[model samples]
Structures are given as structure tokens and as C-alpha cells.
Target: MLQRPQANEFDSYFTKYVYNVGDKNINQFLRDQEQNIVHLYNTLSEKEAEHRYAPGKWSAKETLGHINDSERIMSYWLLSVARGDQTDLPGYDQETYVNHGDFNKSEVAALIADFQRARQSTLSLLDSISPAAWVRTGVVVHKRVTARTILYIIAGHTEHHMNIIKHYGNRLT
Candidate 1:
């Protein structure tokens, strides 16, 4: 089982995501969360998916798109660090990515499919890491992070958005 990353393993900004994971088994938690999110999102109507909780906030579809994009980026970081890459990875603006994504224009089903595919890719990458590689460090957005911390971030990031999506669902009902 993969151990939880220490606070020093990641940037303080990501503490919420990491703590959101708590003591759950990382591998199983990722798998189960994917299934739960996919199943929940599958039930949304097009109109419901397009509803934004606030005027400036992301709609449900855009939120899922953001989740997919973040997982892919973090997975890449995980791979790079696990492979002993010493390069410093840059940060991305989620708002800019979401604006360009045009997720609101796509079918909600399509966004959900994208989420599943991205998650599967992340899982596959995680499966291939050697035990020693989990502790490998890399610079991301100027902060030093371990390969395992990236994994937790991916999971925590999803969890954070899942909570928002759930709130959206509540308001829709």
C-alpha cells in the first residue's frame, strides 16, 4: 500500500487536497471515486449539467473537464518524477484551461467519458511505478514534491471538485 505523503512532500496550497484523502488507501480510493463520480455524472441532464451555481463559477461539465485536465497534468508530473527527471514543471491556470476547454459546449456524457479515460491513464501510470520511485522528488511550480504527493494531489483535487459537484446537484434538486 502507498503511504500518505508528509506535509513537507507537497506545497501548502495543496494541503486541503491531501488532507481530503485522509488515511484512505490511495489505489482503492482512486478507483472507487472514479466509479462514483462517473455514475453520478451519468445521471445529469444536459440542462442540469450546464447549470452554474453562481454567475462566475464553472458549470458541472466544465468542472469535470477541469478535473480531467488536472489529473492528466499531475499524472505527467508523477511519471516525470518517477523516471528521475530533474526538470522543474510549470504551473497552469485552471481558469484559462477551462475557458479554452469549451466543456459547456460538449455533451455531459462526453465530459464524463473524458474523465474516465484520464483517470484510467493515471491509474495505469501509477501501476507501473517502482517502490523506490514513489519517494522520488521533483520541482513543480517551484515547490519540491514527491511522486506520491502528486498522486495524492490528483485524488484530492478530484475529491475537492466532487464536493462542489455534489453541492451543485443539491441545488439543482
Candidate 2:
């Protein structure tokens, strides 16, 4: 098990919550997680994906959709910050996003494909950045965060959600 990178390794551009993700490069981590995500998605049938562990919780489809949305938004942040933009990025309302996801009606296969596409785009964008770009600091949600830390946080956030899906929803049944 690889422990997260130390705090000081990245600039303090991110909020304490995200900065806590430590040293994993956001793009690299997402690339690595692709295999695990694919495997997990493939293991489930349409019915399995729709099954939620509890009422009001997200189903597997919704979770996948959320990951796709999250990656896309994070990618946008990465792109702007990587270009040396110092603008403050706004935070999103996750509950609002989830409520509108319509996961119950979406096909599981398409949802995962959307996630893969978004992640791939994010990776391509990150891979193109110059070394100096990684060190740039920007504000998000009133906290200073470096591009490097942002990347790691994005990856870790997805992993965190995936773990929840596995343990609570996917594994329960």
C-alpha cells in the first residue's frame, strides 16, 4: 500500500482538505485508477448498478456519473491553473449535482464510458503541462492551492468515492 505524499512536497495553493491529499500527481493517479474502475464497473450488471445499499444513497450508476462530473470539473481547474491563471475557482454543490444526475435512467455502460472519456481528457491535459506549471498557485474556495496538489487531490477524491461505492454499495449485496 502506497502511503500518500508528504504535505510540504506541494505548494499551499489548495484548501486544507485537498492539500491533505499529499504527493500523488492528480493525472498519474487517475491513469492508474482506470484499471480498477473498469474492473469494478465491468463486474456489475445493470440491475446491480441500480441497487443502492440504502434509500437516498447513490446507486453505482450515480456514483460513476459523479466521478465523471468530478473529473471533468477538476480537469478544467487543472487546465486553467496549469496555464498560470490565478483566478479563484468556485466550489460546486455536490448534492445538487447528484440530484440532477439521473443515474437511474442512464445506461451503466455509457456512464462508465463517460467517466473514462473525461478521465482520459484530464490525463491528456495534465500530461501536456510543463514542469513549472505544476508549481503555480491559485485560489479555490478561498484557499491557496498549487496545481500539483490539485492534481493529487482530484485523484484521491475519486479514490475515496470509489472506496465508498465498493464497500457500501457494490460489496454489500
How does each model score on lDDT? Answer: 0.91, 0.75
When summed lDDT is taken over every stretch of 10 residues in candidate 1, the lowest stretch is 164-173
Candidate 2 local lDDT, 80-152, one digit each (tens): 8778888888879887898898886998778878888887787788668888787777776766666766677
How many clashes (backbone atoms < 3 Å, residues ≥3 apart in a chain or on different chains) does model 2 have?
6
- Among the numbered candidates, top TM-score falls to 1
Off by over 4 Å in 2: 1-28, 169-172
Error of 2 at 80 (Å): 1.3
When superposed on Cα atoms, how far off is each prediction in RMSD?
A: 1.0, 3.7
Best prediction by lDDT:
1
- How many Å off is the CA of 133 in candidate 2? 0.8
